[model samples]
Each structure stands twice: as C-alpha cells, then as structure tokens.
Target: MTRPRLLPVPLAPLPNELIGSYLNRLADANRLPIRRIDALIATGRHHSRDKDDLTGWTLSSIERLAALTGRNSPALIHALPSLAALAQPNPLPTPPASLTPTAWKTKVCQLCAASRGVHGLAVQRTYPHQRICLQHQRWLGGRQLPISPRFHELIRANIRHRRLLRGHRDPLQPSALHDEARTMTSRWFSNNNGPLELQRTWDDRLQMLNPDTESDPHDDRNLIEMVTYPETVVLTTLLSKPHNPVHHDFLAEVIRSFGLDPRSLPALHRHTTLPSSMRNPDTPSHPSRHRPGSKSTA
Candidate 1:
C-alpha cells in the first residue's frame, strides 16, 4: 500500500516564521488539530513543549511540509530563516562565545502578520539589530507603542544600525559596539545627576510612551531602550573611530546636538573604552589608549 498525497492549504507562511508556527496556522485554517497535521507531515517524534523546536526535523520533513502547503522547498526556506539550518547536513553555526542571546524573542508585528493573512501569533528569530518594524513603525518584542513623531529618531537610528551591520565583515564587532553603546546610554539615563537637558528629554519620552496615570515608565526597560536608541547609535559611531584629540570639538558639537551640555562629556566618558582599532598606535602604552575617560591626562 502507498501513502496518499496530502491536500494543500490556502494559507502561506510569513517571512522568518517558525516552522511550528506555520504548522499551527495550517491546522487552524483547515479546522484540524495540530497534532493530526504534525503526524501527517513530521516523520520524527514531535516536541510540543517548545513551539520553536525543530530538533528532529530533517530535509525530508521540510519537503513534506512544502508539499503539504502547496509551496516549493525554496519558498519555505525563504520564509523560514531556520529551515536552511535544519535541512542542511551540518548543524547551525554556534554564535560567538562573547555574545549572549537575548531572552526576548519577538513576534511578527500584529498588523504586518494580518496584512499577510496570518492571524495567528507568529514568532520570529530576530537579530540583535532588529528591534522595530520600519515598514509598520511598530516596536517588536514588547507592548506596541502608538505611532508618534517621538519615535522617528529611533526609526532613523535603527536604519543606521542596520547599515552598519551590513558593512561589517565580523557581526560580532558591530554587536559588541552596540552592546557598549547600550551600556553607556543606560548608565547615563539612570544617573539622576546627569545633564538636566538630557534627563528632561528622556522624561518627556517616557511620558509620551506611557500616558496612563498609574504607569511607571521607569519600570519598562523596553521603553527606555527605545527612547535612548538614537544616542546609542551616535555613540557607537563615535567609538568606532580613532580617538583623535582634534575630535573633541566635534564630540562636543554632537553632544550639544542631543540637547545636552558639552560639559556633560564626563558622563559619556565615565566607563567607556576605545576599541583597539580606534586606539592611538604610537602611544600604545598611554593610559588613555584603553580608557577614553583618561583622555584629559593624555
């Protein structure tokens, strides 16, 4: 006896969607339990605990899914970023030891998903640089914020961050730079005695994002990160360049551009270090070579 061909469903997978999510959507569309659909498509033991799990999936399983969905394997691969890794003979490359994965995994923007006929929740394996949906102007991985002019700066910063990521050969370099920038920005934001102008700017942003009388903006780390993103991008760019003494005027100008007093430079200098590539090679032994805060002594 031979197995029969499965009927194709009308629903299609969204970009970067998990294979499990697509299967669930298919089951929902056809009014069948996901287990039935899984039994039909997945030859290996299915794990239901983690929705993102593709542990036992082979190339044949992906091909089965593609056939069941009336789509080609390439189409499925294009839609599911992790499918290629699963289909390949080799395991996925391990991320750099220095880089830790974020605890948060973002869902596809509700509006973006609905636009593609995907009404069910669809989780995505997003990169560190991917925080906002530029097309829909929605923040991912957290409660959605209302569209406002205040978020425009964040959107612009994200654009620059993406561009930076593209130009770098080692993604870890950009990731490290972003991490450092986030640390500086977060620290400065938490400093009550920091520049009053900068503090007021962030406070206004907090109010804009959280208008409810009882909502404490300080409690929402996502909101704080979003509001501080512009400065972070700017600082990342500054730190990537060589620490030129002649750049102090330019640095102060950039600080002033953020509505911060140039004298507040120490707040940015406090804990930040210059990247090795950005350090002065002639004065390798100089204390300021490692720490940007010691520039005055240099």
Candidate 2:
C-alpha cells in the first residue's frame, strides 16, 4: 500500500515527550508498521542521534517528519524545547574512562505515559532533578509510575533547588547534588536516633503512599528513596555554604518548604547533634519561633 501524503496528528509537547514516542504514535495513527515507516524515513539520509533503540532525531530528520506530517519544521522544533540543544551539532567529547561518572539515572513519569497509552515503561524520562512532577503534582515512584501524595514539600524543595541552579547561584549540577545528598542522608539516618513518635509518623506517612499487598509499604528500598530524596535535596541547598544555620527558625523554613517539621523528623538530627561551638545558644532550636504549633507533615 502507498504511504498517505502526510500524517494528520499534531505534535503535542506534553512534558518530556520523546521523539521515539512521537514517531510510534504517528505510525500507529497512520496504520502503517513502525519498522516500515522508520526504514522509509531512514532513506531520506537525515542526521541521526540514537539512544539505544530510540533515535534522537536531528534537525534534518525533523524536516523529514514535518514533510510527512504536513507541519512546518520550524514550528515542530519550537514545540520540543528539549531538542533545542541539538539544533546545532556541538556534541561533547567523551570523558576518559578514569573520569567517567555514574549514578541513578532518570526515569519517565507514569501518569505521563498512561495518558499516551504507553505501557511497560515509556520513554526514559531521565531528568534526575525532577522527582516530583509539579505540573501533575505526583511522585515519580522510581519505575514509570505515580505513587501517591504526601510529598508536595519534597517536590517544592526540588523545584527550589532547580531554580537556584537556573539562577546560577549554585555551581554543582543535579547529578553531583544527587550523589552528595544520598551520602549525607544515609549517614544521618544511620548514625542518629530520634523520638519514637517521630519515626512512627514518617512510617505512617510512607505507608499511606505505598501500593497494596505484594509490595510491602515498609520495603527498605521504597523507604530509602522516599526519605533520602527530599532530605538530600534540602541538605544540598543548606550545604551550599560551609556552615548552615542550625537555629530552629531558619531550619524550620528549610523543612517547611519540604512539607516537614523541624521538631520531629529524624532526618534533621544532624543539625541537632552539632557541637555546641556550631550552635548559637542565643537562638533556641525547638518548636519553630516563626509559627508556634505548626503540625509536622511527616
């Protein structure tokens, strides 16, 4: 059968949409086999940027896609902000093996995938700094799925850190922060002990978000990710300077942004345990002076 003059679908720039996704959807709507259409497109001799199985389309490929979709190339490119960097081909040089770094890679948002009828994990969705989808107001739940609520504060902290980087105040990238934050959180949680009520409060909050049977709400991995993610993000911000304020009022502002309380959480134990030399006796560290009787979210 002959290919139709052009696909009729419009390119929707849903958050972090992948080029592979757009192509497959286009193929599905056109009632043509993906491999066949892909092969035909390959014949156009366009530039290629392949990521494993998915090809990160270049400007030339976008033009080909535009011709097939009956859309303007410039308009299509404008819609995909993520691809703007690729418009010009100044690829980075690979670092030597000794200098290569690695950490937990980014993953896609489940809600974003399901909306497009994508299954078994959609596109990579690998923006490490983006743990919570502020747009959709959901947690990224590790694998391509949305877990539940009760993480808005953590999400807010994540957004604030990103804004800091955007404003050029912080020199470290999200990946570096990711590594340090985990280290700090792990050490703090393992070394310090807090009130039992505080521990229970955290556990109960996580339980409310966990899925039913089969997967334990108290699973070690889930707890670690949920706890460390926000802690590290907040810590990264505080650690920006050699010394961070240990005073309850300032600490409260930081924790409040994470939807947490300074008085009850174990994660904040480090600030409490600092040497008296580090603490200011004049500034008390307990129920926040900013707002008395504010309940802890976790």
Candidate 3:
C-alpha cells in the first residue's frame, strides 16, 4: 500500500529531543491533530494510553515518521536519542529504572526551541548532570533563569561538564562526582555556613539572576543551585582526579582560589575527612536534589 504524502513543512529535531516531541511539533506545523500524526506513523496496534508516549514508536513506525517528515531514518535516529533504542532489534524494556523518574525528562530552553521554529513547550530526556544551556545561558532543569554570559566560571564549568560526559572512561564517575559536589554545596548553602565572601558571592548571583525583587519565591532553590554550580563543578573536577588528595590543605586551597576563607567550612576548621562519596570513588551516589518544582530545600 502506498503511504500518505509527506508534510509540506519540515521541522528539524533538537538534539536529544524525544521522538514524541518531534511528532507533536510536526503535527502543529501541518495543522494536524497529534493523533492523526500518530496514526500516520503507527505500524500496528498501539499499547500506550498516552498518544505521545515514547514506547509507541518501533523501527517500522520510525520509518513511516521519516517518510512523513521528509527526513531519513538515520537523521531521525540521530536527532532523537530514544529512536536509537527503538531501532534496535531487541529494545530494552519500558519504564527504564531511574532513582528520580520524573527527572528523566526536562524542558528544553525556549530560545533554543524557537531557533528550531518551535515556540511551545519542548521536552527532552535528560541526564541528572544536564542542567545549564550554555548556548543560551539559561537553566534547562527548572523555571527559566537567564544567566549572563559574563559568568566565565559558570560557562567554563558547563564546558567541563560536557567534556566529562564525553571523555570519562568510567561512565558512572562523572555523575558520582557531580552528585556529591551538589550535595555538599547544597548542605553549605542551606546551613548558610559558608565563608562570608562565599555567601556574598551567592547573594550577588541571586540578586543578578532575580533583579526584579529582593528574592523570587519561585526561583530560590534553582538560584541556589545555579549560584553554587561553578564551585560544584570545580570540586567535582578535583575529586575526579585520582592524584588530587582530599585533605584539609587541598580543600583550603580550593576555597582560597575562589577568594573565600577556607576556615569558614567547619569541616575544614576541624580538619575532618570530606564526605565519604568524595573519599571513596566506589560509593553509590544519591540522586540530585535539584529536581524541578521540588519543595525540598537543598
């Protein structure tokens, strides 16, 4: 049987975009209902109650979607990470286990979506470490907080994060380091026990990111995460290296590099060991505490 003609307008998929999101954009572009687009690509009986569910697509359906969207299968697979699994002969089972299931998906930066001609909500699967949109200087994991490009440390941290993900031999090490760093930083931020200079730095960032008010009720936690991100990344990088000793002097020097007093951290003052996660590389890291809309502080 001959397939239906391709849509007149072609929409490009954003990197790491969900296949379902692409279909919705495709439907919106052609003024078709999402179900109609789904029907066009559906190869057999659909099992998902939600039409846009990721599990709905198969290799055959991806081919049909390629035909309808005027894109090749490889291109579709490349643009949508989930499609690569569906293209496999024996795909992994559904409901992939995650410590934080809701965090597996995140909103894409609106500016980035608009650049691709998408002006609506665009969600993509994301790893825990994927937080900032270095391209647009916006926070991807939470309510939109536009950061200034002048924050060289934050930008450099984002770059290092990308490199860590790409270059690390052990896939789990980067995430472990990031999680531990975030935990430690969050503890300090919440306790309000960091050095006076460090506290002022965070306050400065909070003010800059939320200039309209003394504080933003909606963005406080996210702001805290953003303010601490550079330090978090720096600590992560230091711990990721095997040669970097986790001693008081080493920690003190790192604090001094940020132009903050090291003695302010009680851990440093007492010369206690760093968190076990930092000391032992094999320690299982906890899930990130910075999930969107989470009321849990730190």
Candidate 4:
C-alpha cells in the first residue's frame, strides 16, 4: 500500500507579509493560544485566501481589522489580484487594479437583487429574514437538487404576504357595508404606515393603524410578539399601570431596565392641575397704594 503524499500548509507564499504579520502580532499582543491562532489561520484559509472573500466584511469591520493588522484593508484589497492568485481556483477574476473593496462588494453578482434564489435554479432565498445565508440555503433548498422545507415556508411567507413581511400595510378602501368603527380601523392602518406583520395584523387599530381583512378582528389580542428591535436600542416601556396615577413604579422599572440615566432622559415635570388661564390685571401701585400712612414719613 502506498502512503499518501501530504501537502504542507503554505504560510510563507502569501504575497504581502503585512496582513500576515499583523495577524501574528495580534496573536502575540492578545497572548492568543496556538489553538486560537490555528483557528484564525484556518478561517482565512477556508476562504481559499481570496481577496474578494476578504472584502465581504462590512467596511467598518474592514477598518477595524486594518487597525488590528496595522495594514489598510483598502490597500490590501487593491492588491487583491496579486494576493488571490496565491489561492487556487480564484473565485474572482483579475480586472483593472483600480477597483475598491466596497465597489467590489457592491459589484459582486451575489448582491444583485435580480439574481436571488427564487430567481435562480438554487431556489434559495435572495433576501434572508435577518438570518441564514445563501450557500447552505441553496444546498438545502431542494430546488438545487433536494428542496428545503424551510425555503418553502420562507417563500410562502414572503409571497403570501410580501408587503407585510417587509413591514408594509395594505390599502383600505371605503365600504358602506362596514360600520364607521370598521372604517376607522381600516383608515387607521393607512395612517400608521402599515401592512403590519401577520400577527400584528389584528392589533388594536385605534392607536396607529387599521384592522386587516386577513383575519377576524374580534379575536385580536396580545399582538406585540412579532416585534424585533434593533440591537443598539432597548425599549423599556411601562405596562399595566394605574389609570389615575399612570403608575410611577412601572415607569421606574422601565427606566432601570433600559439603563438610561434619568438626567439624560427628557425632563418630565408633573403638573398638579391643568392650565387655569387666569388673567391677573393688577398693576402694582407705586408708593400711593402701599399703605400710604404706614411709611408716609419716608
């Protein structure tokens, strides 16, 4: 039996030592263990050392990585053809050296809205619901060969309610068959900038939007579950507060949970009463009205 010939990992062959050196420096500065270093190296290698693969990072991430590597990612990206040549079966083609990283990401056929999965043989989604990626999605998406149940569900969700999934609402038309209350509900959706999510389609229309024709309005309850907030923002709103007091305790809990300083919060002063609008037309009398006889000697 013949022993298999093993290929040695090629470290020294990388065109520019700059990124490699900085990665090494990071390993040293962070006191990164050998395992961590190997993982990092493997990660870079897994991409087949393609420069465009490197550019897939958000520009901000690239900037941060540059700060880490002590080399400008933009410059590194500019030198990509030379760099990517080191990788076999280079995924990107050699074009004019003038292309920039952001330009490259923007140019990649994958990002083009027109080329998405439903649009492709892959049957994978072009637009992800804030999670999942195109490749595995394609492999699993049976349309490629074996169809994906998840892809079907996702497509059904998107097609069944395209506008709603995108957080848009349906247009309500006037109909006398519906009562004034129902009319108000439909128009409310128009006013609130909705085709709310499937669940929210039944939420109270009195606040911001109108009820939908999609489901029974009478059954509406607890429609806030679908809400997903941005990572940086934390909403700590009050709930189940007293009608009269407006419940200060719940408000405090919200503030505490939000981790927002009251000082930074907008000033809110409570008024014991509404505006009286009383007009006092009194002019202070000079010395004449001031107890004329009391200080008259002055």
Best by lDDT: 1
What global local distance difference test value does model 2 have?
0.51
TM-score for all predictions? 0.75, 0.56, 0.71, 0.17
How high is the lDDT of residue 115 in model 1? 86
lDDT of 3 by residue, 1-298 (tens): 4576788877878888766677777777889877787688875443222133455556678778788878899998898876787677786556412212223567788888888777876778776467877778777756776767656677778888878768878645666667766777777677765566766777787776677775573347777888889888877776676643323234555666676655564444432235454433632222231222336543
Q: What count of clashes does model 2 give?
A: 3
Which regions of candidate 1 are displaced past 4 Å? 1-4, 8-10, 43-50, 90-95, 99-104, 170-176, 190-195, 242-259, 267-298
Alpha carbon lDDT at 293, candidate 1 = 45
Q: Rate the local accuracy (lDDT) of all candidates.
A: 0.68, 0.51, 0.66, 0.28
lDDT of 1 by residue, 1-298 (tens): 1232656564788777776777777777889787877777765665342266667777777777776777888888888877777766777577754343343357878889888777777777676577788888887847666458756887888888888878877756676667766776787687664466767878888888788869788878888887788778887676554457433433454476676777676654443343343334443422333343444454
Tens digits of per-residue lDDT for model 2, 164-227: 5575443334445455555645554454443344355556656666546677654555465665
Off by over 4 Å in 4: 1-67, 73-128, 138-151, 155-298
Every model: Cα RMSD to truth = 4.9, 10.5, 8.1, 22.0
Which candidate, 2 or 4, would have the higher lDDT against the true structure? 2
Give the alpha carbon lDDT tens digit for every residue of 42-143 in model 4: 433322111233423334444444443456555545433334343334465543222111111111122322343212111111221222223333211111
Question: Model 3 reaches what TM-score against the true structure?
Answer: 0.71
**Better TM-score candidate (1, 4):** 1
Look at candidate 3 and give me any clashing residue pairs: none
Winner by TM-score: 1
